[model samples]
Target chain A: MFPVFEIFGKQIGVYGIMAAVGFVACFLVGRLLIRRYDIDIYDFALTMIAAGIGMAIGASLLYAATNYRYLFYGFSHFYEIGWSGLWMCVKTALDGFVFYGGFIGAAIGILIYTKCAKDVKAHRDHLLDIYAVLVPLFHGFGRVGCFFGGCCYGIESPFGFTVHNNHLNPAINDVNRFPVQLLESGCNLLIFLLLLVLFKKHIMEKRLIYLYLLIYPIVRFSDEFLRGDGIRGSLFGLSTSQWVSIILFIFALVMLPIKTKKLKAQSAQAAESDAD
Target chain B: MEQQQGKKGFAIASLVLGIVACVISWWGLVLGIIGIICAVIGLILAIQAQKSYKAIGQKNGVATAGLVLSIIGLILSIIGTIACGIVCAAGTAIANDSRIANQLLDQISSSVN
Candidate 1:
């Protein structure tokens, strides 16, 4: 796991670089999809940027929130600690980020974008379907980055591989662990492909986002069990992400019915008006 | 037209706050904190303006700019705050450590004499 390496005598994180790559890839693919749908490319770009900003804030805030006890302890012991200690505290607080937080943040960003961008506002549902496709596509790359960064690692297994001299998490060093990151990455890629196929076939239409919501939460909940990292925080023997997954899954289930009912009502009303 | 003006006002306010936040972000810790607060408020106002524009079937360029700028300013302010905190903490630690070391040397020398 090569977390950091030098490029032209400058240190760069593999995770950050991969995430950036994923962002660019998402934007490029999004542009293509938007063009195909006859949506304004510029507006798509702006919305994508907004989603990126939201993702950054949401991810960091969730990271900090999950480690709230540590942050509070740091603040409480602020007067007693040296500069190094303070640096460590702040660094830790800023380092780890949760993906669910980013997803929620991006959703908010899209909402804001829909308001701000005229064309996007007019075609919000279509754009959101595209956005749903992009999520797993981007996340797939991010999980690969996590693999390279040696974070979000899996539990020990005889069939797994060992990571040696891992500076990021020394606890996992020399320990044979399940390759959970790779597994998640593979799963995400499959999901991305499945969504793309659904999109192409026009099967779900505006309900694509709901499909993602229904699918991803189950995968995340199951994958959480294989995750070895404790920094994600846990409550009642379930990790934070697991709890979020449960909520998202149930929310999706409830929303699916309501959305179908509303769509039906709208179509019925349109039909009645046409008959008149 | 009146609602449009209201939306414009919020957009302008958001843009101004966003600019101020970015400008003062790197000044100091307190200023960075202020910048962050301003950015957050600007973001909220920008969202409100965007919502208003959507309801009225219009798009406000200024509001979009405000939202984007506010996000930038907020991120910069947060980074600035962390950087400032780290530098000050490191300086204090180095100074305190050196001072303690000096005092210990003086005590040892005086006791020997």
Candidate 2:
């Protein structure tokens, strides 16, 4: 798969280009979607910046966790390993990222933003509603980036892409891979369309995030089976992402009912007080 | 409103920083990183300026331009960083793996023949 292109005498990553494209698309769509809400556009933009920073930190930390042995060895033998060797260990430990880590980090980032920016917090439900709509749309483009970048590849199969010249992940080279990235991208786009329809019709109101959490995890859980990248550690015979998906699915299932119950209790309390 | 007018200095600073970032991003890795930092600051300033206008239900042309330019600078700086990092990492991998070097060389020689 082609990952890089020559631009202005520099080798620009296709992944970055796709990311930029995704952000622009999200910004335009989000602008339209938020018109119904009282939230400011800059507040939304600032929240996204927080999410981006959080994603970077979380992904790096998870990657380091995956290579803990290397990090330990690097630190323990600091004298013998020398500066270059230590740097090598550190670099190898932190070079890659886990998508699940980034996803969780982004959730925390948004939560933190709402807490700090009280004005934005007042419109929390509306903010989350728009976020739920935009996540899948942006994710679809990211998967496309993964497809071209030859990362997160599908399992080996006869009737699929025979990727070569992928120097970064040489495991992908000269293999007929199943193109799971593109498949997931397509699935994400379909989910995005469904969410968009729901948003446009104002069908789910503030519950769109729950709907997304329910649907996307099922999709992710099933798709994890098709992914060939085995670097992501598994626990209890299930890949990390699959386990995360299951946990998220169950979390949503549990939280939705509790959230509904709380809202109902609050409204009932307000009614009783008003009557007095 | 007064609040919107009060943010004019921020909009101007954002525009200036964004312009500087865009110019320096093309140079190399270190400059690219610095450019990205500048772009980020510019973006924040622009957002603050725009938020003031938006709060009062007004639009500011300068804030819009700053936002647009800062985004462009960020993208450019990111591209430069990606390109440099890729070249470095791939180069190191190639140096260590003889099979990869052989494969690449074979391809080149085959094409030449």
Candidate 3:
């Protein structure tokens, strides 16, 4: 119901506000981390700009590509088309932003920016750690937006959520639907908090960022099952994302032991050399 | 030697992004090539950056791993590309056949009328 909040003449969706909130939260976290580790602010600013723009463009493009039907379909009836015209296409393109797409896009933007940046402080691990934490936190807000907009609705359940009646969204049928969007947001928040704790304990290194990869896909892959939207697809008896998750999880597990062993060996060598 | 945190951050970001790219575009041939290129290029740059940092007396192996991850991403991207192509072609074929069936239905209805 509150998906499209009218502010002045413009309509701002909850998703957009959530995105802004995520950005602010990320900036604050980044600033705090940079200050703690004596990282340069300019570098943070540069990377944020690159990543933010990348996420936006990437999410939008992916949404348009994946949901091409709804976006491309003129309308089942002439009366519907008469009201919107091609403007609906443009609107749908903008509105169908996907989270995974944005994540990849932002990462690419940061990578490219890092490659080109000339500043001395641009390549700091502390900055990376801050980003690592921020990505999940901000993405959490985006999921909340999804919930508010009723875009990523859940399946039927006995005691489930109902979309309030409003101009922007009708009361969604099926009361048995699980609040999957909220569940996702909750998971993301938990991850963010966990990351914060690790950072506070000074246990985080650049390697910790890779843990995000291992964790997020697992959460998303599981959540795919509860999603009521037509987005879920099973490939060879496993959900597409779940299949990807299995591979990524296996890869992470394989790498973890080796990485730990390598670090132990390196530290041991250092200790021996230092003693000599 | 203590590695500066900044260089490590850059490397990690590059590696994560590279892996993500490989996974996302894994459904398309062009995207797979691009993902591999990104991963490779990212890995090389990250490695160079890590080396430069180490040369200045900062020991940051984490950054080095980021470079290595990018290479892994490149391999995964290639695999993803082949998978994506097969799926896409199959999907396109199915959609085309469906469209033809729909057209035939319309034609049959008109003839009967």
Candidate 4:
């Protein structure tokens, strides 16, 4: 696994490079989408800033939440661990992020933007629908990043890659493991294509976000089963992501029909008013 | 007619901060943290600048540049932060477990002999 590579005597992470590429990709795609969807450019930019802030906060908080025991250990052994040691522990603890948390955070971010910007509030669903498509697009690149870095690795398997001398991920060194990151990346690609098609076709005009919520959780829930990493916290025999998946899946299931019914009623009322 | 000096100043500040962030991102964790903060502030400034430009019915290319640079800086800063964190963790582990270090030294000495 090539976690970090040297360039001009500076170490650069494969994960960071891929994520940066993903952001650029999203920006390019969002530019086109903004025009297509008639979204205000200024509002779009502000909303993205808000979402970026929220995603970072949410992802980091969840990472720290899952590893709170380490914090407790560091706190209790402050003298023993030393300031630098405690700082290192905090850094290591925060190095990991959960995508589900970022998703929730971005959603909250959009909600806040809608509330703050009345002009954009009218087009909330449109904004959400487009952002939904972008999520999978960005995540596709992110999963690939995770693969080269050997962070979100798969279970041990005979038919997989054997990583060696990976100091960044010693756990994966000399072991042949399932390529879950690639699998998830592939899944995200498929989801992205399908969502793009739906959005372009105007098939699920205002409900694309719910569609994403419906699909990704199943993939994530299954992904947890194949993940070999034991860093994330577990509850009731299920990892935090698994629990989040169940909640998001059920939320989509419940919210979809309600949203559909509301949209239908609003359309019917508009049609009647137009005829009158 | 677009004389929002404060907004233009924000855009300029964002651009400068973004440049600063990218430059410092390669220095590793401690400076990486500072780089990240600079990038975040730059991003906020870019967003605000964009708002001001839009309010005046104009697009500010400088703010867009700032936005892009800030993101790139943020990514690089994260990389530096994690890279140094890894180094620090490794150092701590070796300090805590001298056995591994001793084994390595013994391996080297036996090879030399």
- What does chain B score (TM) in every candidate? 0.70, 0.71, 0.52, 0.68
TM-score winner between candidates 1 and 3: 1
* Clash count, predicted structure 2: 0
Worst 10 residues of 2 chain B by lDDT: B83-92
lDDT (tens digit, per residue) of candidate 3 on A97-124: 5676777788777777777776634464
B1-113 in candidate 4: lDDT tens per residue?
Answer: 44554388888889999999999988866898899889989988888788878777788889889988987888778667643114222322232345754453344334433
Which residue ranges in model 1 land beyond 4 Å of their true spot?
A79-88, B1-113
Residue range A145-246, candidate 4, lDDT tens digits: 888887777889987898888777777778789999999999999999999999889988899999999999999999888887655656788878899999
Which lDDT tens digits does candidate 1 get at residues A1-276? Answer: 776676555444577556756776897888877776787555676677678778878987887776554455456656655454555556556555689999999988888889876667877878888989999998988887777777777988886778887665665678899989889989999999999899888878778888999999999999889987665667799888999999999999998888878878988999999999
lDDT of 3 by residue, B2-76 (tens): 254346657767767666665654454456657756775666556556766755767666666676677567555
Error of 4 at A270 (Å): 2.2
Best by lDDT: 4
Chain A fold similarity by TM-score, each prediction? 0.93, 0.93, 0.79, 0.94
DockQ winner among the candidates? 4
User: By TM-score, how accurate is candidate 3?
Assistant: 0.60
What docking tier does model 3 reach?
incorrect
DockQ of 3: 0.03
Which candidate would rank higher by TM-score, 2 or 3? 2
Best by TM-score: 4
Instruction: Give lDDT: candidate 2, residue A69.
Output: 56
